[model samples]
Target: MTETALLPGPAVVASPGDFPDWSQAASHAATRVPDAAVTATWRALNYLCAAQLYLNDNVLPARPLRVADVKEVPSGHWGVCPPVNFMLAHLGPLTAGRPPGSEVLVVHGAGHAGPSALAHAYLTKTLTLTGNGPGWSAADMRALAAGFPHTRAYGGEITPLIPGVRYTGGQLGPALAVAQGMVLDAPHRLVVALLGDGELETGAAAAAWTGQRALLGSGLHGAVLPVVLANGLRMGGPSILSGLDEDELRAYFTGLGYEPFLHDGSDVAGFRTVLAEVFARLRPLGVARPQPVLVLTMPKGATGPEQVAGRRIAGTPAVHKTPLKDPARNREEFAALAAWLASYEPAELFTDRGQPSDLVRQALPDPAPRPRPAPPVEPLTVRGEQAWPLVSAVIRERAAAGSFRLFSPDEAASNRLRLAVSGDGMPEWASEILNEEICHAWLQGYTETGRDALLATYEAFAAVNTSLLVQHLKHRSTRTVTGAGGLPNINYLITSLGWRNTYSHQNPGLVSAMLETENPTVHVFTPADTTRAAAILTVMLTGRDRANFLIADKHHTFTFPPDTIREELTNGAAIWPHLSNPGPGAPDLVLASAGDVAARELSAAADQIAAARPDTRIQYVHINDLTVLGQPDTWPAALPDDTFARLFPAGVPVLLATVTQAPAARALLAARGETARVRVVGYRDPGRPLPAADLLELCGMSATALTAQALSMVKEPR
Candidate 1:
């Protein structure tokens, strides 16, 4: 075996003599050789999968199986392994002829089947060839086997740690949506998302089927190949789709704008033939209009042990994980595990060096190199005083460049942002779906692939996609550790806050949920005015590898000086000198506010407080980014202790008004070890519809309440 020199960074370019052009030869050989090579590869993958879960040593057993070879605590799912392995085997040959500069990315919806991904990665030499892990030799295989579920080199599920895996679908339902986003506007890319039938029950997955409707008029090139790995069992019981026959399954998918292709795995050769044909038809540039879906139905735990301890396991949920619970301690279970491991005949598929044999090697495709990012585009020239206008300007520029998209849950007009239109009078670069999950998925997928996108939704409803956002945060974090180039930030324009909305539309939990993560990459920007919102929006668009939540108001609000807001954006918070009384070392009180509406009330309170007590020295501080209030160790954007002291002097009574729950601000302050006597006022949700001002008054966020609170705090003894 030759050592393949990997590129310096995440991008792995192939060297001259690294990978032989085996596609042509393999294509010609396929005419005469029955699908034996593919079968061999699949068998090898199955053996590796089982080995990862059960074996701690003797990876390629040459003697009689013994209990010493089994792991003390075998773990990992087995039900979805065989089918995933089967798909990888067929995909290798099918993707061999893909055009240059194209990619065949796979998203494992059933992420619990991590063993399958690891096995495939090892077999194809992806881990070694790409420099993501150790070399694919006998020693490395033994080390990997010993590591089992605790390897630092790989995660427990499909993760960025794996060379070929991009999206981690441990939280089911986003796989299809993420895949759709990846293929949007990318014509040469073919993203195959392997989804379990159980995952289809998720609301996100159910809504993802309608994503095609959003891309109908958009002249994008790439297509998603949804491969439904129907094993007929969920985590605990039979899957809902298991009751549907072939005809029903076809109709179900066909109704959702897909050309459905059903493959019954009973006949391996027949299924392989159909899979190859489908791949060939969908790999072309323009053939993915309607998109293609392959519903491959196989039994759960297809090639694993059929029975353990005299209980049927295969085709049942019992085989979901570690079919033989204690293979190392129980003699009967150990024998069954040994038989299962022997069924794949590891000796025939691997050489004495533990490397994949010639037959298995010939069946896998060369690992695709990571795509280099497109050259940086010039920053868009945006000019506006209002939040919506500023956001719209950025959108228009992105739409014109054909690289920016906006996914909104039918709130573009409501948010006062004009949707861009193409020459054909259709919405261009803007997709409006009523489902927040779908909108979030599209934006996530698009941005993760290096494109720019933003998801706009009402503030109250933004929490609906909190789970998706968290998953993406984890994905970006893992990708960063892998040295993969930074992806565009996942930006969410959270507008129409609960302050001005009716009873049912009042909720600020999204802001709190994101703040709770305390993730360095999570930023919550609560710009005090429209000018600040525009400046922050521009920065958010250009930022990388962070999740930004921009909470603003669509209605006309106060405007601040552009330069002042620019400076505020940089420091995350700044004292408005013009709105405060200039005095000595420390002011008698510090009045702080975040959010446009909250700032308006604070500004009014400052004027009243000044008139009432002319001699009282007061400082007005406007917080543009809420994350800055936290400790710098937890959030990079957090204000430093020195800067914080300068803006918020010690022992100065501070009255803070925010748009989110009061506890959120208190938590950040506590994290920063702030000793200032501070009283926080924010949304408490009156629980029913009321006038905006009345609601603010009830929540103790009105100007009168803030003024009274500030006066009492200032009058109190130091």
Candidate 2:
């Protein structure tokens, strides 16, 4: 292994004054890196990373050359490690001296490279281990090595278990958007998003490039340093981005409104110099809106084994995972693994006690505590029959508190959310983009980083971000299991129902997709009117660790007693006494609705039933929260058996009108063993360029259709 001499200098420490002024340091290149601490730290991280992947016992290898020391089932990706390690090592220096509020945050886009992050966390003393002996004892090291991919605290992916990992990149394309959100309104902080080349192919990633435009003129906001690790190959083969030349790549980013900086990873020292210069340039632009992107090209497995059995591994796809598959059984491969591990010279990096040496320790940043947002205030209360005015009032109140934002897919005005659009165009606190993926990701990023926000878009177009929503649900669920601190809910305002849209714009798949997750944190709320919608919105905005979907229509307006709003929200569903016939016994039929438009039709159907059959008993139920229809075991908000029985009698038949697909509502009802007695009328996607009533009638959701279904169900024998 080639060696670089360590330059002597003062020890690096975490303090506000330690950060260098790049503008002045650029003139003194020799003095810029007073020492080779970053390189030394990188070497130590590389050694620990290899240990996590290959060693199950004898982690420090005090005595080597034994098959028992090698893991029986060695696993983890190696292709993405070196670049990630390089970034992490350098970032330590850049972020070390920053104060509490201005600290730099990192989001790992290549989640498969978990070992690298785990190694860094261990070296920095930020990782929680079995025993707390300053996290440097031999026992702690052994425990970390034994845990490997199956650590009880965190799996082999970037998650909240690791400190500072706000955005989990299990799925690609949302990292950039999420990073943008972390810095939104946080002018002093900076987020460094390590984006992989393969992730660039996703539609969300493509849309995220243009997402910066939304932040350009939006007042003072923190900057996101997007570092693209272009390693030339993905899991399967060569990446599509690898085909572009340097000039072409520059043009691509330049067109997307970024000043692109291209660097070669082959020259580590040269790259570090360039990286320092980039940070220096960015330091003066604090709170200023200038999007700078850094493109770093390197080999797939830069510092790992280059070749084994005459097969090239380092730069090839073969090194994606466990380059030497069964090193313990194969003598040649075993020898190769030993040499690879020795290349980093663990003896030079770690003390005999299995702790990081002073050389490595001095290069690392102090473990800064994660920043927490201020506690949420009481939910805003707005009373009105107009949906936009009431919803807008809540939004305005949150914005005034300086901790809330609104993101829309350029449909805020079309959806009658004029409050989101200012006379000067998109405001600093509110952004309107044309891509739903970006809008959803931005809100997710904002909320996960300790603030509240909402994404408002047409219900049909909301499906565009179904994948993003599911990813977030999984992310939040994992956070809950790990006991991470609470984060505000991801609130979505779903509007422009299919009943009012053309065939091309008619799909309620977003709701169905969310329901399919069966995640306890997923809450689908369908408020009946503007008053109810406002109430639901306020509750969701102030809640935590949930993904709340508030479905309501802005085109129509209806008034309900403001006093009853709390009861409806609490019960999820409640009887609308005014809309039902006076009765004390079990009703012949129950009329229920779970959406605004569906509620209107159901109300009209109730009038028809009451007028035609004054002698027949009837009851009306308005469902403000749809999850209550599910079994209590699956969703916490789901009504218990007794409550469900009381609201929906066992003997009486029920006719439900919902905006979601009928099958979805049926599935929820099936959980309660009530599917047989319930008749559902909902969107079947039989939409067209017709009037609202015509569309509803075509889908069997019209008031006349609902009335007929109710009458027929009541006539059936119990």
Candidate 3:
């Protein structure tokens, strides 16, 4: 194979290549492909997508499409495209000579800039390689352009279904942290994340900035090269990062412990040179700790029309979206679009078959196959009285295997996980960061990179990453549905009960919110004791492609033996026959409970009810999986009607004591069409510190409250 030259020759007069570069100058040129010509073609494709809105591979002949071809709603942003194109152009060379199985995973932070990314994918024949049911031909390219922003075809943002795309956009800030996680423990891979200036202002992004400290000290095998697209605009206005000068940008990143690299995105050759040097120094093996590199590149709308309707679009907020697209009644703008597309000279860049020309293909790298994850290892089992020992045992086992990581907001030791600390007393497999947001990013990144990890935080503080968790759940669930592949389990251990804290720390509302999303992959577990918690966690650790939320109190708690635990895991609920004081035939009232403290209270409530009303007869039920209460259609864990009938009986009054707010339990009962007969007593934020029993009573969670509520319901009607 011949070595491809880095730069093409200068453009002669009267040639199509005579177009000016991003700097808008002919003198600033490179020796390989002309920057202006490439950027023009890139802009043309972007304009085509914006103008046509909805075209497919079936669209005939690849000339400039007409405004009549436009869809009713043209989606996708134009402003973010230029910088994406510029980044892709510079990125091409980095992957050209990479060894087999080694890949440069590009995490597109600016997801709406899909048009520019698709254009790059098409130009390099990457789209062809990863495309489904489509050959690498000119017709396919046109179809891809046309079908974009359409769900049937590729849509506005990158999804797991797309080949070579590991990250999704649209959600702004997680990509940076995601990129960091993608490269973890994978010595052969490098993740180049392109972040939008607008996304940098998000709270998630801020979390990633601080999370970098954990990443640096993590002893990771891979590195992240974050390229900030410092374009002047976001969607409709100037971005926060756009206001900061280069010196300030450098200082900010430097203060965050990164070595900042500044590059004018308009200067193609300069960026290429700078990129090569950075890759050379950082990409090599044995760099002690892998320090991240942040490049500040300004290339606002570098490929869109410089001016439209006598108003400047490039380098302004106007360029953020389609600038020359009005299929309805704007013929002048349509005509301008035609001229702009003509300048790219698409015919010269692609063959008649819609495939990239040989010259262009030579400049791009072959899309490497997606990496496969290792199979899950066996789970740890502990038939013990304490939950932390079981959790610590697994952490140690996984840490030895070099695939486990734990992130906490400085509560590991307090949570009885002291055994997981290192020789120097630092957490070995866990990092005790004080920021929940940062810990959330670390956990997200680590799991996204194909590792089995856990994020342990106080139940209330978990809200800090609620949006982040939702986005990830979306990404993972999509992959599962699309038959792409399974995502590694993303486990969240929420401990430190609200009963132990004042109202300020009692926020288990995320459970209700998560359940409401109706995400099929979600499994909410409320372990009633250490034995049950161990059983649930073991399954979670060994599970595949599911988002498991394991809620348990960190304090030492009573535990059942191993056999009972197994029975509980299988049934999703357990019946303590010995503890039941039901009457001869069917019980008059069924007392069911979930969560540790709540269940314990219910047990005591059962005894009191039996003592107070000997003829009442009570059946005691303990639920570990909250989903069991949902209708079968909504929850596979739900009991069959016959089983449910046996547990609660048709008209027997049911009293459910739960750890979450009462509404969540009500929602579950409503889903099962049993709302009329069941009464739930759960957390109500008692507002001040009190004894556990006092708090429970204040929140209508005490055995006394539960017993009283059950009697009222039973005595009310026929």
Best by lDDT: 1
Worst 10 residues of 2 by lDDT: 1-10
Q: What is the TM-score of each candidate against the true structure?
A: 0.93, 0.93, 0.89
Q: Report the CA-based lDDT of candidate 1 relative to the real structure.
A: 0.77
The residue-level lDDT of candidate 2 at 555 comes to: 77
Judge candidate 1 at residue 206 and give its lDDT.
Answer: 89
Least lDDT summed over 10 consecutive residues: which range in candidate 3? Answer: 1-10
Ranking by TM-score: 1, 2, 3
Considering lDDT, which of the candidate structures 1 and 3 is the better prediction for this target?
1
Over 1-718, each residue of candidate 2 has an lDDT whose tens digit, in order, gives: 0000011112122342233343342334334333467677888887777887888777786887478888888888888888888877776655555433364667777788778877887887767767653377677787777788856677776666664454566678888888788667666556677888898988878888776776656655656778999989899889998999999999999888777889867666787678766766563222334457899887777888888889878777887887888888988889998998888888888887878987777667666654445566676766543656778777776777777889999887787765643463555688888998888878877786678899999989999888878877777776677677588888999998877877788889998999988988888898888777877888888888888988888876866555556778888988887887737788888889888898888899888988888877888888888889998999899988888887888888898999888888889889888877888888885533777778888777888988888888878998
lDDT of 1 by residue, 246-315 (tens): 8899899888877788986777688866665565446322233566789988787888877776788887
Give the local distance difference test score of model 3: 0.66
Cα deviation at 378, candidate 3, in Å, is 1.6
Off by over 4 Å in 1: 1-34, 128-133, 280-290, 384-387, 421-426
Which tens-of-lDDT digit does each residue in 1-718 have in candidate 3? 0001122121111232121111111122234445554454444445444433444332333555666555545556777666666666555545655433344667777767666656655554455433465366655665676666647545566665554454555467777777666555555556677788777888777777666665444553555677787876777778788788888988888887666788876566666656655665453212334444656566676655777678776677766666655633576666665565556565666667766655555445444443445667677655443555776665555666657777788887767665444453654456766777667666666666567788888989887777777877777765665565565688888888787776688889888888887777777898778767766877887677777888888874666444456656887787777567776887777888788888778877778877888777778788888888888887777888887787778877788888888898799789878888788888887666777768878888777887788788768774
